[model samples]
Target: MPQIAIGMPVFNNQETLARSIDSVLQQTYGDFVLIISDDGSTDGTWAICEYYARVDSRVLIFRQEANLRYMNFKFVLDQSQTEFFCWLAGDDYYSCFFLEKCISVLNHDASVVCSVPKCQFTAPAGNLSLAEGTFPIVQDEIDMRVTQYLYCPSDNTRMYGLFRSEVLRDSFPPRGFHAYDWALSAQTLCFGKHQEIDEVLIYREKTKRALYTGAVLRDERGLLKQLFPVFRMSVWLLRQKKFPRRRGVVRALIWLNLVKHMEYVSNVHPDFYERSRFFYTYLKKRL
Candidate 1:
């Protein structure tokens, strides 16, 4: 088996799929398998993946007859047999040393679930710009802060991070969550801590078709749909007997979600004020 497996789930990303695949093919660390799952793309995504598969033995491709979203993404990762696992989106590409540096962290520390290297953000029409790096959290403080900051009423983390294969297997993402990254990060923290590297190894593309493109706060119904799965995850963590710190983080996330719902009421969903008020009051008492 390859030392590392890079999994990507593609859906209608034909325009940028080739570039994303090339980015993985160009990785400095050559002993890795690029696993691409074409989730029933009607566009040229499958053809592009096929072309790359024929040319490179390292590239593995699969196709589905129907579209599957975040839940199917977990399936792709589950299929990986590599010692280390990372994911690249169909619309995003990574720097040459991304896998090399991330794998180095796992090599150095067997306990570390993942290492997040410095990230660069790029707009479709503009050049790449440096983005912030997360600080290492031996305890759960930094993890809590990251959760709060990313899911804040007005802020969201622009960059994405990688994860270890075992970590992914241990803490699968909650089904049907629109903000799957939030749950993934929470699970990573629960399994093992993360370290941050200063090397800029991932380039996040700010494309219009990307998931978080439109106004999040303005979409009240959509926001509520996203929050339910997160709320369920928090409840699941609270029932666990493992880490007390995780329970605390779950409480914090509950309040954050309540506050976010309240913020939505304050701005766009005034008619739902009573419902939001009830949720806040109930959660406030529980916390």
Candidate 2:
């Protein structure tokens, strides 16, 4: 059995799937298995997956009857019986040393359940690099990490971190919605410390197909739908024993982020400012 299992859930990613697979195949750490689940892609994504599987014995490919979104990732995660696991997107690729460094961290530190590397973004315009700031190592204070993950304004980069398979399996599965990754990150904190490595190992490609489209305030109806998950997440957090004991603080933070998110959406997509109406207020008050 491999020491690490990388679950790649893909959907209609034919255009850039090859590069993603190549990045994984060329990893400096070779003791890993790559499981790719094509979520019923109508494109040539499955063909590419098949070719790579034939060439590399480590590559295992599966095809879903329909698109299951986050559940497809669950399918891949369930198949992994390794010490460490990672969820890789079909369009995203990682540096060759990503697994090497991440696996080393987990190997050395038994308390750390996950290791998140710095993220770099590539787009048609240019490249953007995000520094991994001083994120908390919450081995002792798990609640601290949980609160920060719930409220802090961070990218979904942490979601792709190398995770202890047992701890990851114990955490809640991601919701089948827009901000599911955010919720997953929060849930992971309840397991153990989330250690951050300063090196930029992951390369994320920016495109319309990406989940969060700039503040997510495309319109009143759209923004409301996107933000509804926050309420669900708040309830989910409150139910978890490892979450902050102060339920009121959690509730306040959730609403505060909702308002800030709406403002950000309005600023980026100004046309929605007039259309958003009193929907956000209703959501905040209602939730």
Candidate 3:
């Protein structure tokens, strides 16, 4: 079997699908499988995946009946049979040395569960800027990593890093609601610390932030659940028994982060935070 497994989940991403596939196929470390799952894409995405599978022996492809959203991510990762694993969004592309560098980190340190590189955000209009790195997650202390990760605003690019396949499988919990990615991330911290590479090598396309659109929630059912999302997400994360000893500490941290999250969101996304911007307004007046 190959040393690494890469899952690429695509849904109506025909425009950027080939670019992502090409980036993977161009990796300097080529001993890996690129698993592509078409999540009921109506566009030419399936055709693109099929085309790559035919041309590259390393590429494997599958198609889903419906838009499974985050489940599509799980589906691709489930089919993996490799020591190292990572997920590459259909809209994103990585540097040729990405896999090589990440694998080196994991090989050199058994304690590191994942190796994440700094990501460079790109827009359709060609604007580009490097995302900040140095997440407090590198610490071996589980509570420190989990609390810092939960409290701070991340670029949401760490999940795209190379993970030890066993830890990757264990980190993922059963899907429960919107922002399930955030929950999985917190859970990953429970297992081990993640190493972040300082180089800006990952090129992630900016996904839309429109709340009601398919951008935030996949199925319409998630709309109601998004109300009070911070607590809902925390409740889901706290249910896991991964860190039973740290539950009390984690609980306090969650509450603190929840308030901070509300304030952060209201300031960063005031329009989506509602016209009242209650969190921003109320906190400002009180402070």
Candidate 4:
């Protein structure tokens, strides 16, 4: 099996799919398999993917019968048998050395379950800017990692990091409309350590994307469930026996993060704040 398995899930990303695939094919570390899952794109994404697959033996492609979005991510994960795995968004691309450096970090440290690099965001207006790095995860404590992940103001760049495949298998699956990465981050911390490399290795396209739409968001119950996924996540974690020995500490941390998450979301997405606040109130009553 290849040393690393990269999962690229595409859904109507025709404009940038080729560039994203090219970035992976150009990785300095050559001993890796790129699995591109076209999430039922009606556009020319599959055609572009097919071209790359034909030319490069390292590239394999699949197409879902329907658009799965977050669920498509799980398809690639199920196919990987390598030591390390990562999910690359359809529109994002990585630097040439991203794989080489991340693989080296995992090989050198048995305790480290993930290696994340800094992120750079690119906009259609030709503007570029840096995002968060591994600095937020500088501390070694697993509990600290979980709390900081909840409180820290950072994108989900770490979720795209090279991870030990076994830990990925053990962690919780993606859930809810948003912040699935945040939920998974908690699970990863419970399993092992995560190291962040200072260099910016991934470029995220600043696209206004919504993971949920249509009938799902139209229903009040569905919207509420999607808005307050942390509650489901917390209950699941407890059932899985993932909380640390000091259960009270874990509960307190969750409450603290819940409040901070509310504040953070309100500031970042003001329009969604009132709805989130309503769901949070509903969450409190449910708890």
Candidate 5:
């Protein structure tokens, strides 16, 4: 069995599936299993996976019988989990040393649970831009680390980083909700430290998404759903029993940020602003 496992769950990603696989297979740290789960892709994604598996014994491929829309991410991880594990999105590719650098962090530091790399996102236009910051690596207090995570507007893409397999599984949520990745990271942070490597390793492909498409995955819809959401997040975190109660001051900061977010929304969507004001007024009256 390999010390590391790479789970690639893909569906109709023929345009980038081979690129993603090749990058992982060509990693400097070569002793790992590449598990590909095909979610009934009508495109050439399965053919690509098959070709790679034939060419490289380390590549293991599994295909679904039909287009089941199964939870492919967790499915691949369920197949096997070695000492370390990571999910490589079918559309994203990494630098050759990406694995070597990430595994090195895990190897040297027993205290660190996940080793995330700096990422550069690729726009559909083919332009590349480096992500501004990542989830911080606070070595000591869990609450403090979480505060840093909340305070800093960091990319949640760090969830794709390499992690201790057991820790990852243990941190997995019983059920997922909106902003669940934030919940996952906070839960994992409680267990041990997370280190973000300085090196730029992964090139994440950004999907073109339409605004207000009624997608459940989207965090925002309009003023009704978006109103004072950050403040609510603060309340939930402070009240939660799993972690220590964060400082009350956290809510105030969240409130301030909420104001800024509200302003941005108001400028971009005037109708949303009008609706939010009336809605908030109604709630205030009831209170």
Candidate 6:
């Protein structure tokens, strides 16, 4: 079995840190190291991490003096030394065989750079529930799925995935991107292929503050800015003629952004509509 490195960035997640750590420690695949980056957490998160590190040599803990977002996550990932890597959020837990199954796919296919597994979402106050039936089983599938989701606004299927360490290291998430996972997934698809496993290996915690949640939609301007990269990437992919399975979806994505830009201007920034007209025009031409 190849060695795996799991990078986890933690903030003030005292309520779920212990459970997340325990799930990693209990993984059936034992040849793995856990790198925990505490981004200046104010709660008892650090203390809990320290306790686990003291007992388990596999757990390596680091502390960031300030609260950095996904950029800090990239920093910690850079310090890992393993053939495979995956991130587990401070508030999420993984199945004992999560790493094993993902690694198996990578080991089987040299061209595949990542493996995305099915996930279960759970609210802090409620029981864990199945969020979706399955995610894309390959990179082309992810591209198509992402495009459809963008246009129709449905629950996504490609969120929880394990990536090749080198691929992730080469194309780190851009700072200020809404979520590292989105940028990382885009990069992984561009550089290499991906395998989709149907097993629900990750249990995602749906808290108000969780970065992946749709809460950013409340900030219309922020949401539009964040989505710009996804649109940009889609345009690039279309030019490259990659993921032909996703061509239709990509076209829809472009139009979706155009619609969103119009809505934003009509509702919030009517004054800037003239300047933003270029964005809408560009998207319309592509669509």
Top lDDT model? 3
**Model 1 C-alpha lDDT per residue in residues 1-287, reported as the tens digit of each score:** 88888888889999889889999999888998988999888888899999999999999899987667666577678789987787788987888888888778878886677777777778867876665435554455545643544344221222245567776777665554435555556556666667778777777665443234233432225545444434544555445444245455656776766764565454555677765687777776776
Tell me how many clashing residue pairs each candidate has: 0, 0, 0, 0, 0, 1
Model 5 clash pairs?
A: none
- Winner on TM-score (2 vs 3): 3
lDDT of 4 by residue, 73-108 (tens): 878888889989999998999999999999999899
lDDT of 3: 0.77
Model 5 lDDT tens row, 111-179: 998898889999878898777545556659877766666655455777888989887777665443334
Candidate 3 C-alpha lDDT tens digits along 1-287: 99999999899999999899999999999999999999899889988988888999999999998777788888988999899999999999999999999999999988888898888989879988776533537776877778677655455678888999988788676774656677777788788878888887689987644433343334325434333455565676667778534664565455544554564456556688786576556754443
Error of 2 at 83 (Å): 1.3
lDDT (10s digit) by residue, model 2, range 31-63: 999999999999899999999999999999999
Q: 1 or 2: which has the higher TM-score? A: 2
Per-candidate TM equals: 0.78, 0.82, 0.85, 0.82, 0.79, 0.74
Return the lDDT, model 5, position 3: 91
lDDT of 2: 0.76
Off by over 4 Å in 2: 131-139, 207-227, 247-252, 260-287
Question: Model 1 scores what on Cα lDDT?
Answer: 0.67
Give residue 96's error in model 6 in angstroms.
0.9
Q: RMSD for each model, in Å, please?
A: 4.9, 4.5, 3.6, 4.7, 5.0, 5.7
Question: Top model by TM-score, which number?
Answer: 3
Q: Model 5: how far is 87 from its true place, Å?
A: 1.1
**Model 4 residue 109 distance off true place after TM-score fit, in angstroms:** 0.9
Task: Name every residue pair that clashes in candidate 3.
Answer: none
Using lDDT as the measure, what is the rank order of every candidate, best first?
Answer: 3, 2, 4, 5, 6, 1
Candidate 5 wrongly placed segments (more than 4 Å): 65-70, 133-135, 209-214, 217-242, 248-269, 274-287
